[model samples]
Target: MLIVEELHMLLLRPDGRVESAVSGNRLYGEVAAVLVDLALHGRISFSHEKHPTVDIVLTEPTGNPILDTTLQRLVPMRGKRLQSLVVSPKLDPLEVVVESLVVQGVLVRGERGFFGWGSERTPESDPAPELVLRSRLAAVLAGTGAPTQADLSLLSILQNLNAARAILRAECGDISARDLKKRIEQLTAGSPAGDAVAKAVNDAIAAAMVAIMTPVIVAATIT
Candidate 1:
């Protein structure tokens, strides 16, 4: 599950200045970060409240030899710099948005690019552009509630490691996935719903990935 909520992001630029504000909703910033983490580790787990604004715990990669050191650097800052960034091998940020929305069930892949889902299929079908959807999702996951079905659909895209990671880097600011994975492992260790929620979220992500990517992959290979 993505932790989408409004957060106070305070960026300390090179010149010893402090820039702070509440940004990054569920679809864009926060969900983007989770997607990046999932690509590197294969799955993620977090906690949710009865209402919105739940705290989540992420699991890190255990076997990867190179991840230990990276974990050390990232674990301490899990909710800080690590929370609002994405990391991916690909450079197209829109890809992440596209994949996420498709997986989450918001925008469906049509003959052309992504199109919004509805019976009418009018020009207003996709009321929010991809960028707006991303931003809104990030805000919701951060504890804000501006998210719609579209935002949830986009988040579902992270179920695929390849697409999820690619989208992460393209859209959100770059961060280290290996490090984020380690941090999640340490943070989510003791939660009550840790194990069950992790499995559920992972399962959902997997199902969504197969549902969407199988066709695309087969077509690409054939072409």
Candidate 2:
């Protein structure tokens, strides 16, 4: 599964309900996941030792359509701070990924509007995918086993966003918040990013997590 896919999955409720996945703030995290996936895939390198902030530099192409396209966008942006890529008012980064999920039968996109006045598109996920995802995460999160790439990816998102507690509580009401903290510590201990890119990725992830705590920041990122 793609990092973006799991990121979207995390925002969904177990009963096919979506909390929020199409916002600038949430998209920021989603985009960071995608970028991290690329970095992990060796399609780019990050130079974070610059005086002020971190910078992203593209490497060889991965030949994957979505990832390659993202790299193409970053090519001309040399010397640009990585933060710029995390914020894009003109595009909803999750739109294409959500549509792909809909096509895969994992989600159904529906319109919620009144007489074409204020129509908005919403996503409804299939419960099976979510159930599977939740089970894998719950097991790995609370388990003492080694985490696979997919598990690490999901856990990274959870840790960075401070979402483990909320997601676990939603999944299992009897679960304690302490369990979530333990899982985060476990997953964070195994981050695979090198020193060069680690700072950039961490900064991006931190910004996204901060946005989760502040709705005003979320609103600021929107048009």
Candidate 3:
């Protein structure tokens, strides 16, 4: 399963509904994961061509049509900042990722009608994936042992959502929030990527997501 899917499932409840709207954080964070995964798999490479710009360039066809298409889109963005490339209107990576989950069995489709006129087919995560994923994350957060690469990736997504508190409280022992925060710090500090570019890209994406979410957060607070 993709790390991003696991994160989505975690935010999903047993009743087949997401706890929050499809926020910018979740949307862009998943896109960032796909980009980073492709980079780690050697399908792409990231470099700074000029000041304050990290460009993603495809190295080879990844064989996955969606990823390959995204790679093609990146080719023209040779020297653009990663943030700009992420928000490019030409692509909606979140739709691609969520559709993949729906195409798989992890999420199921249902219909909903609003205002008595409009209906939409929405998908929500299956409980099974979230159950297993949450258990695994809970164990790791409790310091049961060292985390695997997948675990590290999961940490990145959940962290970006600022869902650590909910995750720790719901999935694990009666640990303090501080402890949960510390454990996440420990895990990310030891993220097994071993590639500086991947780490930098991940950090940049997380930062960008934070910026994207901040306005939404404030508007919600004010309302």
Candidate 4:
């Protein structure tokens, strides 16, 4: 599964509703994940400046419709700040991810409420994928295993979304929220001696966090 799909799964309830804590910014989280996935695939890269901009390294199709479509949209957006991509009215990463999951039979699209007055719901049709994903993340968070670059990227996006605690609470067992936060920080903190790929992933994730959080911070200050 793509990191973005895993993120969407984590954000959802068994009944298909988005977790309350992340409902407001779920799209942004998914968008960030998509960008991180692209970076991991070597299809994109981020600048090292204060406000990092995204640049497409390759325009070749990724075989995945969602990524391919997003890549096409990003063609004109090269050198744009991550914030722009995250908030772009034209880009609907969440919708694309959801559709992909539905087609993969991971999620079932249904409706709820009175005749025609209801809203659509996407309940889980298959729990196996998410189950495996959570298990890997649990092992990493529990310090029982090492985290891969994808793990760090997903965790970083969840942290910035302020949904990590709620999403991982059950899997984390008795681990305190403070400790979980610390562990995530330690894992995401790139090693100066790490390989170039790891460094690039870390940079992409960090740039994504700044892009995802800057507007919220600015709005809070203004209020």
Candidate 5:
């Protein structure tokens, strides 16, 4: 599964509702995840600066629908700061991601409430993928093994969402939430990938945070 897909899976409960704690930031996280996946696949690259800008290295389709769609969108936005892409309402991919997952039989769509006053729900049709992903993250976070570049990317996004503690606390054995948070920070800071890869992932994450927080800060100040 693509990292963004895995992230969507992670952000969901078995009931298919997005985890309440991270719902507000889910769109930003998914956007960042897609960008990071693109960078890791060599379809894109990031500039190193105070606020990083993304450049498309290859326009070839990635075959994955989500990545391909996002790539097409980025074609015209080359060299734009990552924050711009993340914050743009046009870039949110939740519906596409959900549709893809539904088609893959990873999630099953249903409805709640009576009559027509209901909301849609997408409970899991296949739970194995998410279970395996959770185990992998737990192993890495528990210091049992090293993390791949993908793992680092996912960790960086989760940390930015302040979500690692909520998602992995149970699977990480007896580790305190405080310690788990610290482990995520340590791993994200010192990714196991080579320097260039580490820098790209870290910079993308930083830009994502700026994009996510800018509106909240503005709204708070205005009020």
Candidate 6:
């Protein structure tokens, strides 16, 4: 519970203001608990276990020393080495931060074209619309039923119009899952990313099905 709360405080808010995390001028145990939960959930994974450090880079460069310092202290307490990266319209803070984390053994950089700590070339700026769409889709697909990030990311590889529609229908299911699967196979043909997208859609559907199957626990369980 503490880890859960700490993560809530550390994450950025839409309004750009640090909320309940600042309360009492001390990071509560609850906050730390929340972050741990996040780590377990796979939203974040151990990049490098050797250094035991975490890095928080500032790309905007406005310089919020208080926030930065608070995060630095808060993260190390949770067990990690910390570093900061600064990026701008011209500066690649993300790259710098990722590199530092990789060096410190806090993160495992990804392959040639992937999202994570390390990459040979910088990625293009993704628009908010794309981010929001991906997020919504991801929410509709997660948990045990959730595919590994690799399977879920296949949507990016598709560029053709028909193929995209087929994949969307299969995952979304306007009528039947079987029908959608059939259509997807028909559209996929020989495309490399097709299998990936198909896997993603299946995972997405499986994730949603699990959500529906799960029961909410409102009361404490006693041994």
lDDT of each: 0.35, 0.61, 0.62, 0.78, 0.79, 0.30
Instruction: Supply the TM-score for candidate 2.
Output: 0.73
TM-score for every candidate vs. truth? 0.26, 0.73, 0.75, 0.84, 0.86, 0.18
Count of backbone clashes, every candidate in sequence: 33, 0, 0, 0, 0, 23
- Per residue, candidate 6 scores C-alpha lDDT tens digits across 1-223 of 1222212222212222223333221122222222232333333223343222333332222233323333443443333321110001121123333343344443343335345343243222223432444454434332223333332223222211112233343335353545434433443443454243233333333333344334433222331
Candidate with the larger lDDT of 2 and 4: 4
lDDT tens string, model 2, 98-182? 7667777887766556675543454555667767777777666656355666666666555566565665565434667676666
Off by over 4 Å in 1: 1-175
In model 3, the clashing pairs are none
**lDDT by residue for model 3 (1-223), tens:** 6554565566555545455543334556556666666666666666644223545554578776557766777677666776665556554454555566778767766665565454334455555776677778777887776676667766655665566676446764776767766777777787656446445555666667667768989999999
lDDT of 1 by residue, 62-142 (tens): 543223333333454454321222321221133343344445554454432237333222122232443464566446444
lDDT of 5 by residue, 1-223 (tens): 7888899999999988889878777877888878877877889887777677889999999788888888888899999887677666666777778889999999998787577465578899999988898888888887897787778777767776778777666676787767777877788777646446456555655666776678999999999
Alpha-carbon runs more than 4 Å astray in model 4:
112-119, 190-223
Candidate 5 residue pairs in clash (backbone atoms < 3 Å): none
Q: Order the candidates by TM-score, highest first — what do you get?
A: 5, 4, 3, 2, 1, 6
Quote the positional error of residue 112 for candidate 5 in Å. 5.8
